[model samples]
Target chain A: MDRFRLPAGVRDILPDECARFDAVQARLRERFVAAGFRFVRPAGLEYFDTFAGADSPVAPSAMFKMTDRDGNLIVLRPDMTLACARIAASKLGAESAKLCYFSDVYDFSAAGNSDREIAQAGVEVFGEAGAEADAAVIGFAVDCLEAAGLSAFIVDIGHVGFYKGILEESGLSPAAAEEVRACINAKDAVGTELALRKNGASQRAQRALLALPSLFGDAQVLSEAEKLTDSPAALASLLHLKQVYALLSKAGKEKRVSFDLGTVKSLAYYSGAVFTGLAEGVGAPVLSGGRYDGLCARFGKDLPAAGFAIGMQRVLRALERDKEVRQ
Target chain B: MIRVALAKGRLASSCADLFIRCGIRADILKEETRKLVLETSDGAFKFFFVKPSDVPTYVEYGIADIGVVGKDTLLEAGADLYELLDLGFERCKLCVAGFAGVRPDPARPLRVATKYVHTARRLYASRGEDAEIIKLNGSIELAPLTGLSDVIFDIVQSGGTLRANGLSVLEEVFDISARLIANKVSLKTKAAQILPLLAKMRGELAAKDEV
Candidate 1:
């Protein structure tokens, strides 16, 4: 009998699939380079601490791990863009760096599901923290999505400070605050209410927490959220989003933009304006990115930066479906 | 045209009432027939009466442009759909209930019975507790009393059922209400129709609160 086949979750991206993937990556890469983003590549595996210290969506178990000869823990990179950012900040010396990357990230969760190794093609613009940089990155993302043949989608924007400000004001214990944050992030209104109530939060705080999910939509959500809280951090975040939206609007990308005040990107990092691109055919986000002004500090470098990653697998799925529809 | 998946029970009735209050006719929904599909006179919309748990799947897969479902089902199914609005009706709470003083140690693995296996699993995992989940399709509150499991994860609208069964809520997992969900695709393609309807519903909900 032939040797047991590859795991169920992981699938081989045969020649045809590879062709489509490369087509999408090439278009994105060309656009990034034209926009002044230099190409950078990093190893598929790195010391485990490299990820442990950074804010990433990948869980530890999702990473392929091993012990080196020197008894050091190593992990097959579950994400490339962030690791590359770390490398650029530390190795390349982060004095305004723009890096574009295309690499296969080994994720164990994908191993028995579908496509164990994902070819992620994305760009990271480092050493810029202004609203203009935010707009440039988002504009590049919109161009990339369209280039990859995703026309009908929305770039839902939010800020990390909005959620953090509410939690800080609630005055819950550290543990309770974490629970509330997780619930809010999950959009679990009921869980959030129960957690806040159990933690002895005031009725005003509870109402504010419950309103979070609804506080997202169009440009008007920012103004409405600003009225609900007195925190300057939240106000600044909303203003930053307004500026970014204004810039995108000026750049003629307003129709594709929307705002989501409840949008939370990693539990840590993401100091401002987090966003995800969603199209009709795919269930998961096709692109996810936000500002992480503190990420460089993890690698012993202080640089304010922001970038976004296109989920090549998800984007490919949407493109394939779009193509089928068109055909 | 817009398609709305309505949960086929009390929640649906309440949602239909809200739509009627918002000036949309809903006589077919009130007729109490076993019809699965209904269309408006203008043929601009359609409604599919689906099982509550299946509503999210319908919306997520784009079979339905939108859905009216309880938060309880949304949490249990964990489907990826955009929750566009909270209807604020059909309120309830998910709780871990068992015979009084039957608390199992956090370290010791306990057996949980529920129709919501995923939600139960997540609840236990979040609390750093381990439990073997026994999934039952109905009468979950009877599980512990029947000695089938150590606890029953069920939605509680009131404490009466638990109290009558000599059970008490050990830990409240989540609070739930009805929500309006939209398929990601529908939000973009049918925004002209869907957005206005969403705005109208929001307005009606606000007006109701003021009264």
Candidate 2:
């Protein structure tokens, strides 16, 4: 008889790995509780519409879906943010809420670092739209990471609104905006400039779009961003980042904060302040979150929201690599 | 210090030449030796000479800060790394070929064999052709000759090997060249050092019409 094979992208956690994972999760729960983020364990399966938020990047076709007995389509939670939004809107309506979730998100995307089923510990701040909220979650992320025995990490912060401002002022169609965003996300400056020109974007918009891929580095790059555009929204986006950075400094975590003006988040729902946490040795980001004020509106309630999820496997991988070096 | 994984053989030599031109002490890289790794006399950089295909793997895993490998290997492996620059050496073209004058049956799914499974699969998909890709480690050209596949998707240089194998080029897919790729983290934390090197290389490459 042949040994049973697990499905592709599936891994049976061995005893030692499971123990280590449990310990990490315990520590995460402790820190999250201390930070006043009430825990909410959302269902493992959600409606297909939940994961597909406004302008969501989680393509429905790439999701694992099945029809329930009533013929309503169900899907594994490809993301927890939408589920959090649903809960905040339905049960905890019209009130400020700070919710945290520890769940496994199923990502059926094409082959990459994305695990088919990912173990994630995430936090979502509801009813707060200020830059301080962005700073608080980021500081919490750093706190959890530090408590986990990881060091030499920086949180890369970006703003979708910065580019969105340019597109809005340019009056490009939604399709054209997507094309421009995709090209910029790929860091293909030439392609983006050509596309913008072909879409009849103004010279200012074209120049700013071209400058985006290189709009990365320390806080000083914020000043350099002034050259991108003079639109009030673009300027306001810069000020928003400045405010977040100032709050980060107030929290004394400014050294671990960097601005990536060109970085594009995978989800289109990020209304402001997108960020990813990158460690020194890890090639892929270990933590990713952003402010998505529009997601809750999909659940028929309008509330400002921002949250981020930490990849448990990535953290473990980095730790294991650290162990190998020490040994 | 910056560490570079230079793909062994011809690409390594070309990359070493470029590095030396950029004021980097990379002569230890071009010397005839069986050593797997070497460091420049200046001690500012370390060079690891790995198999041509393993360069990207090392860079992607952060074992080395940067790598010099052909675009074909980068595409096939699809390692997560920053493709920083194109060194413009070891020029070749990825082409599809089979026994001369043989017409591929359009009614059936084409049996394509090559070491570059991802590249070939993408090419077939782009052409809207269903293909059964057969992965081979060595002697990929024999698949078509031995009736194993209807076509072979392989890199062609000067058409010498295809002519010797009694095969003719069917379609030219695209060009391939060496690229300078960096570990994502290395690009961020070591930008102070790596960016200067990249800028210098770009400047030199622009100045020189020839390697």
Best by TM-score: 2
Question: lDDT tens digits, residues A1-327, model 1?
Answer: 458676555667789888988888888878888888887778877988777743454677778899999999999888765586678778986488888888778877652113667767778777888899888888877888898889667887888888777767777887887777666665556567778888987665667777886676688888888777776777787788889999999999988878777666565757887888887666567888888887777777878888888888888888877877689
- Residue A302, model 1: Cα distance from true site in angstroms: 1.6
Candidate 2 — which residues are off by over 4 angstroms? Answer: A1-8, A12-23, A52-54, A110-114, A167-183, A186-206, A230-232, A320-327, B41-43, B96-114, B127-153, B160-172, B209-211
TM-score of only chain B in every candidate structure? 0.94, 0.94
How would the docking of model 2 be graded?
A: acceptable
Per-model DockQ: 0.23, 0.35
Report every candidate's CA lDDT.
0.79, 0.83
Residue pairs with clashing backbones, model 2: none
Residue A281 of model 2 has an lDDT of: 68
Cα deviation of A270 in candidate 2 (Å)? 1.7
Q: Per-residue alpha-carbon lDDT of model 1 for B10-67, expressed as tens digits?
A: 8878988898876677766788787799987777778998888899988877779899
Q: What is the lDDT of residue A168 in candidate 1?
A: 71
